[model samples]
Target: MTLSVTRTARGMVQPSGQTPTGTLHLSFIDRLPVLRCNARTLHVFRHGHEPAEIIREALSKALVPYYPLAGRLKESSQGELQIACTGEGLWFVQASADCSMDAVNYFDNIPMVHHEKLLPDLLTEVDDLDPLVLMQVTQFTCGGFVMGLIFCHSICDGLGAAQFLSAVGELARGLHHPSVAPVWCREALATTAPQVYATGKANPPPPLPFLPDYQLKHATMDITPDQINQLKHEFQESTGQTCSTFEIVAARMWSRRTKAINLEKDAKVTLVIFANARQLLHPPLPKGFYGNCFFPVTITVSSEKVSQASHAEVVKLIQESKSMLPIEFTKWINGNSVGDVDPFAPPLAYTTMFISEWGRLGFNQVDYGWGPPVHMIPIQGSSIIPVAIVGTPPKPKKGIRLMTWSVSGPHLQNFLEQMLNLT
Candidate 1:
């Protein structure tokens, strides 16, 4: 189905109170090289109760506490990225589509091509002085609407973005105050860089663009409570060690995808885990610190090891990745300066997997008086590396739903079969 815009408007969501006049230093995790632009997403509501007026009004109030969101991305004399607290405001757009909610499967299964229409255009809406956040409320003929948002990664991670939206939902429901107050303590997570002794400094490497004419195949698979528990039981029986829900799921994926691709046995495979650092900070961030407080923990091993290894073996590697907290947390925080080479970059090889955990983010809990959202869809920005988004089960089941977007390849069928048979 084709989507058309019925009306469009920009809402100047300003801070409810005066905001400090200065640049907000972006923490090391916030300045990741790959996350330099706005990360787009789609929120679908089946029974259209969210009106443009309500959303805009609630957003204005929500911006009061998260004022930095209304600021623009700018660079300091040292060439470091920071949020210039100008109170410029966020961009709000309203659009309408010709299809019904059922026509698009209620967004439970999305076609890669239609995603472009459901999201705001970054090429035109984003600029150096433009607001760091842009939102579009797209309405459907059947009264359903999609809330599309573009959030600058330099300002916050996915968890931080959810914190802001939760506030908006509360305000829309006529709440006097947000459940969690927004906190800004970017400098608290800073770490001292260890001294480096080298013969000479080499010129920085250049950025790599996405693959040429890449095709993206998107799929959503659901795991049952019984299946989850069974997998955990099997792993514990084999290794005599228990694993978290995330560990079991990630291990299975690593094993299946690697075999499906049939890569060389000696090929190196890296599992990049995006870990949260809110509590890992020495003194801990405020209750609702809404900034980039997560870092990537990458574990690399030969393809033969991961593909042929049991789920328990893979889980052990993932646990090793998470164990880098506290001890490694200090070195990671202090080692990199503002302009230093990005601590990490997107994997240049097809053998790597990037896993993101969204189960605990509470995307479904965000209610704007219309009840909770039925589905949350992450718009893919790049297609070179395989990316997976793990979401909680629909009900209070012990399992989760994993959505993956990967470059179209021959191994898709094998990968899909293995994922479906995990039970």
Candidate 2:
């Protein structure tokens, strides 16, 4: 399928007259290492109303509460990021694809060359002035369409973006207001005490020299519900405890990927996962606190252990790592010095895997008057650490769709074989 651009425009979703206007500082959570990067998402719908008109109108309403999204990001003298609430517009593009959704196999294993056509390009580099978010609405010949969004990680995280998008959908459906009000409490995570580091941003140094480049390859695969259940059952029977689907699946992938690369038996490996802290903080954030509210949990083990350990064993290790969420979040909130290491840093020695679960993120619930999205996918596949983007399966099906991006090395085939054979 080929996509042709029809229009390129920008719209300013100004805050209401009563809304306050000023520079808003980024919270500690917002400055997390990986949060500085940009992320993309695509929402697919069938035979929907005029998506361009609906989205523009709904976005204006959403921006009244999500004004920061319309603002421009700037760096402070200390090198920290802050939103300058100038009411500047966001970039939006309109395009049409020559083929229908089914013709592209519902975006299953979409070619990398074509993926760039579906979303906005990554900024050459993070600069002082740039749109916090960019979006594209592409219509297919069969009347189906997709909404692609690229958001700067400095402004918000996945949950924040989802909340704002949900508001747009609610407004498109003619709701008088959003289901949840947006909240900003950056001061709560700020400190009156002076800091000595550069912006206190603590951007980590580059990875050590030994890490091998993976040549950046991407693929999407699915895991049947039965496969998930079987793994869970086996782990429970062996360990006398049940594990969440994500924990089990992530552990399995970590084990398999390490073995696939034929790493030295005694090399070190690490698995990193971010846990939400909205309700985990000492005094929980507001119900709709829309910002970066998560911390990364890293688990290090030897390659031999990661490759040879039982599924139950790895899951237990992940569980233990997660159990420290509250403590870690509190430390970040109190302005304590957190590790300078990047959570998504490249795995140089043995292996490093970062796993993110979007199934419960309500990707399928962002309805814009013509029912919910039929499909969604994230752009920006990484080549450093292997990444697994897991989402809920299609309706009436019992399973998950796993989209992974890795280096196109000799290990690629073995890694994929192990993943597919798990079912």
Candidate 3:
């Protein structure tokens, strides 16, 4: 169904109260060279009981605590990135759709909903939009709304973004403070440049572009819970080892994707596992750090192995990846890393497959009076890398949804056939 959405208003929203002023040093995890990208998401709500102003106002108040978000991204004298506490404010847009929630099936009909129209355009923005956070509230005729947001990847990961948004919801609901108070002590995760640049200098390398060029067809696949459980059982039976939901799912999907892409027989394929590292630290990061903390664990094997290996073999590789987090986390936070990644590090943008597990991020639980969001959508903006967003299904649904932007043409057809015929 074709839907028409009209932009109603736009402006910058400043913090409701005075915030600290000065530069906030970014941690090693926050300034990862391979993590320079934006995380765009879509949230579906079922009620219009809350006006757009309510969220806008709440966002202002939320900024009082999450002031780093309102600040602009700055580059230090050494080319490293940091947040300058200017508190310029958040960029907000108001929109309305001619159709209702039912018309788009509450955004569950991923292929039918015009996500681009539901989001704010970064190209035409004048709010010093160099990776600045942007939000859009699009109201539907049925008194429901869709909230779209764009967060700077360098500033926060998926879970961190959810925490911040939830804070905004708390304020909207008239809370004096967030249940999980905001914490900004990021220096604990900072790097010391143990290995200087090959030029023997102290500065880090220049950052890659935040977004990858989109040249592949984007599609979302919904896998039922039954299929997931069956796969899990099969994996354990085959490997004689019990694996978590992500291990088996990632293993199977990686194998299937490898076969679909039909890469060279001996090409080395890297599976990047974006594991949450909140608990792997020496003292563990606080519950409310709200910054980039996920450690991208990589497992590289021959394409032949990935395509031919039994689900057990691939899953074991994934298990190995996660098992190395403790040591890797130690090196990263202890400043043994070079620009947060060594030369031997697998180039994440070129990794064979990059999948972000969002099922546990609590993004769908953000509510500002209207019930929890029914769906959390991810917009694959101009991202150049081949990445997939694996997230929890909307309400009343029992399964996971995989939004893929890695393959196209016959590859997509093959992948779809495997998904629909999942046993």
Best by lDDT: 3
lDDT of 1 at 109: 57
Q: Give the TM-score of each candidate.
A: 0.88, 0.89, 0.89
Model 1 lDDT tens row, 370-409: 7777777777776766888888633333468888875365
Counting clashing residue pairs in each candidate, in order, gives: 4, 2, 4
Candidate 3: tens digits of C-alpha lDDT, residues 246-284? 776787778888888878898888877778888887688
lDDT of the structure predicted as candidate 1 = 0.74
Worst 10 residues of 1 by lDDT: 195-204
lDDT of 2 by residue, 69-112 (tens): 88876767766767888876576677777788778766655443
Error of 3 at 44 (Å): 0.9
Q: How many backbone clashes does candidate 2 have?
A: 2
Measured by TM-score, the strongest candidate is 3
What lDDT does the true structure give each of the candidates?
Answer: 0.74, 0.72, 0.77
Q: Which stretches in model 3 have alpha-carbon errors above 4 Å?
A: 122-125, 129-131, 193-214, 335-345, 348-351, 382-384
- Collision pairs in model 1: 191-333, 191-334, 192-334, 193-334
Report the poorest 10 consecutive residues by lDDT, candidate 2: 191-200
Q: Give model 2's TM-score versus the native structure.
A: 0.89
